[model samples]
Target chain A: MDDPEYRAGIIDLLGALAVGELTAFQRLAADAELAPTRADQAALAGMAVAEFHHFEQIRDRLTELGVALDDAMTPFHEPYVAFHANTAPSNWLEGLVKAYVGDQIATDFYREIAATVDDDTRALVNDVLAEAGHADFVVDRVRAAIDEDPSVAGRLALWGRRLVGEALAQAQRVAADRDALTAIIVGAPGRPGMDLAELGQVLSRLTENHAQRMAKLGLSS
Target chain B: MDDPEYRAGIIDLLGALAVGELTAFQRLAADAELAPTRADQAALAGMAVAEFHHFEQIRDRLTELGVALDDAMTPFHEPYVAFHANTAPSNWLEGLVKAYVGDQIATDFYREIAATVDDDTRALVNDVLAEAGHADFVVDRVRAAIDEDPSVAGRLALWGRRLVGEALAQAQRVAADRDALTAIIVGAPGRPGMDLAELGQVLSRLTENHAQRMAKLGLSS
Candidate 1:
């Protein structure tokens, strides 16, 4: 794990994630207009603010690890950008659900990955992930909105599926190409030996969480 | 000055301003997307968040003062809404300037009004105005952007003037109509007014601040 190759890979993955936070903040801030009320706008804007705060911590951690931000983030630039480009949510509720479910899965994935790292990275991960409070707030609002309007149930559930799917696909692509960092997740040198048992465990947990979340909205996932 | 009518008018004016913050946060949050860069978007988002926080305290104070939020804020709402309808910033830099300079003027006006009140109302206004840190941050970004792009100079400066003019017109309307709040500012009923004379003082201070601000940006009023 201390090897140069492993460290390099770790830096790249984190940089991509950091930049992703930056972009999410920008996108959500823009999407806040779709919110029907000032209260709703505040909720989304809170999430957007949290994203940049997350980015700040992650960027600081990258610097602490002696990673050249530009270089560490370079390998990830295109794919991460494309993912957001293709999946930009068009309306208020869609954007809220996107922030909610998308961030839930990402947080789950990050939690899993953090366990695989050494002390420094683990602490940094913990710090950056403190941003989930706003994510939770958004989820409640989205669920409440769906509750107020039953027809929104089907569409948002479907939207949640697409968000999780796109995230999974992009995550897979990152895994395939960034083996150095991917190795850290499975605590193995290669994908062949890497343990996805941990991921399976998380997927089951996330599915349960998602199901409960849907039920909270009086909807079937 | 201690009359019920005067107190009601003061509450009316503040209520309108409070709702204005609420609406501005919503619009600005959505307008954040107009920013061309990640940093710019983050700055706008931060400003939007602060706007929400600003009004929340004022709302809470109104509640403490035995004023129903809806009733207290009812009078100034439509006029302020019309002001926003009449003038909305068209681009990113213009938006930032609108938030920074425009909000600063509003805050200054609020501070002046607060001075005319007794202890609690004054304390509430002072605290509410303190949350403008993010607006200051956004203004710096707008100024830096203008400095970097001389070609943007003329357009932004012109935009800045129009923003101020629209804002000033709204101020005049608020002052002229809210005679009760004006009584609070003028001190005792028959006394010479604080706001009318102080309006000049406030404008002069704003002019000085703007001069320094423009000088820093290498621009002229």
Candidate 2:
């Protein structure tokens, strides 16, 4: 709160998270509609509900920090919404893969960014980012689908790549649009933060985790 | 579980509630998408998540009763699904009104039927039927909309009526099809239950509550 740029960066980070969680809730619920069974629908819908709770937590934190939740969330809304629009899944399997892949990237990004924030904010971010066991459900369903029809593996793999591409593109768009936030991630003048090479390593880790997730789902990264 | 009719009726009741909650979660989440703002979307999505919890509780209870969840839920699935399909709202306001009115009527019917069940099941039904502050949110939003455009009041009032009509028609369809469930409601031979006259009174009470809800929403019932 003392340094204006640092404060703005934190706000920007949380604001983006708030908007991201809100949109994730919407997308997950919509994707759940594509579920083939009531049980599966309930499973995906539960994940959406969990995302809503995360949205609330971040939104409440914004209010607690004396920021108007809507105004704080406004900056990153367009990019996040556009990411979802651009990568809208073509089918149920695609939706599941998107949910899994998209969420993993978001969680990883938040975890990495968590290190640069204050202790309280770091804990909040980490706590909210926990996947709530949705990963196993997604992995089981995706693997079963691939086992049933080996041909789907190629399409789903391609879909996973597209999700990651759209996610990264939107993230870059956000970073470009929010300079303070970008500075925060790459470190301000005297702050401890990621240098360019370290930033490259962060990206590498994100994609590496993405590959592991795809492999777990029986799809190529 | 000793009496076949009683057992079947319990299964039918739980099944219907499970299906109702599942559809409500989907419909509420979809409706949340139409919200004019992210705040409103989160508000409605919170309600949808509450519905999902109720769905899970009922599904779990079915499992505890040694009933196969899907088979237990199957009997009421078509009626609930058809009701949603036929009465799908065309816009945000209609969706809000339908959620409030539809959920209220369902809760009322369940409360009445709860009287015919064992204490444990009755308690479970009542617990799940409690709205998680969703009614106030819907009422506030719907009332504000009418305040913004008085003309929408007439259209919304008509929409409310259609919702109730479709709901009652579907309720009747479920009752006619599920004999054990109907018999439980109307009273098995000597079981303490709603007599025909008592059932008529229940219908009047449901409509009366619906009218009060509409009035509260600043719409004509």
Candidate 3:
């Protein structure tokens, strides 16, 4: 905890999470426009607002740590931008699946990393990552859409797979680019971090959770 | 307050306000994309979320009154849609001006109507219409832009006028289309409503407030 390297790593991790939540807020709000009904739109907007609240929490934490927000958030912007561009949803159902599937995978990855950090940071991560009750809304919408036309399931299943692939690709990009952040997970000098085997297990856990989420949405991962 | 006509009018007004705040959230979120910096984007997103909270309050009030959310919201959707379409901001500065100017005007109108409603409804309206502290951000940004390039002030000023015009136009459409809502403002049987002279005074006050907000943003109304 006294290591400057560890402190920097924690800051890097928090910055990434903060920016990720902000982008999620933006994406969800934009997707709300595709909703078929006002109710659906408001529901998506509610989820977007929830994401913004999470972003605010992380942002305040970063500020409390005396990190200039733009300086911290700037590094991860390109990766997130690329991720969203690659997996832009074509319709409302796709948007719902992306929000649920993509968000769950990211949450799982963060939670895994969070466990390696200090108690306060871990709690902050858990707080932001706590499900905001949007999963049921997304699941209900996606399942109903699939039920309406079984043929749509095949397309959405593929969409879910693409979301996961794009998310993982961008996650890898961030890891390779932000050494401090990767150090938070992979180990820094005088700091305990995930061994290779543990990292493999974390990946598997993320994968399994994503699969379960897709299944909950009646989609094959 | 016991009059069914008055009750229906209150419901109608709440419905219009709920949908208005909901759309305001959507529009602000969409406009956030035009922001030049991440901080600017987050600021707009924050304002959008504030609007969503306002929407939730009004929606809850309508629900408490046993009004269906969609039914209450449905009537004013077209008006709001037209208002946004007619005043779509073309650039970042335009978006800021529209957000600040349009929202302030809407808030003023609602505050006036809230004055005429029951205490509970008036309190709800006041709560939602309270400024969420984004005005300073908008004013700072717009004023800085105008200082940097005086030419923008002309364009944004015109943009501000267009926003007010479109807002008033749609508002008129709503008032004409929804007799119950208008009855709340104009008068119902055995209900004290605004006399024609008072209605004229309300319009003047709204216009005066708009001019002040425009001037605050370094724009002419």
Per-residue lDDT over B1-221 for candidate 3, one digit per residue giving the tens place of the 0 to 100 score:
57878888888888889888988998998898898887898899899999999999887887788878888888888899889888778888888887888898999999999888888989989999998998999999999998999998888888887888888889988888888888888888777899999999999999999999888888888
Q: Which pairs of residues clash in candidate 3, taking residues 3 or more apart in a chain or in different chains?
A: none
- Structure candidate 1, residue pairs in collision: none
RMSD of each: 4.3, 1.5, 1.5
Model 1 alpha-carbon miss at residue B129, Å: 2.8
Better model by DockQ, 1 or 2?
2
Worst 10 residues of 1 chain A by lDDT: A186-195
Error of 2 at A21 (Å): 1.3
The CA lDDT at B11 in model 3 is: 85
The DockQ of each candidate is 0.25, 0.69, 0.73
Tens-digit lDDT string for candidate 3 (A102-203): 888889989999999999999999999998887998888888887889999999988888888888889888888888888888886767788989988998
Task: Return the clash pairs for model 2, or none.
Answer: none
- Report fnat, model 1: 0.24
* Candidate 3 Cα misplacement greater than 4 A, ranges: none
CA displacement after TM-score superposition, residue B95 of candidate 1 (Å): 4.6
Q: For candidate 3, what's the RMSD?
A: 1.5
The per-residue C-alpha lDDT of model 1 at residue A172 equals: 83
Q: Which is better, 2 or 3, measured by DockQ?
A: 3
lDDT of 2 at A125: 94
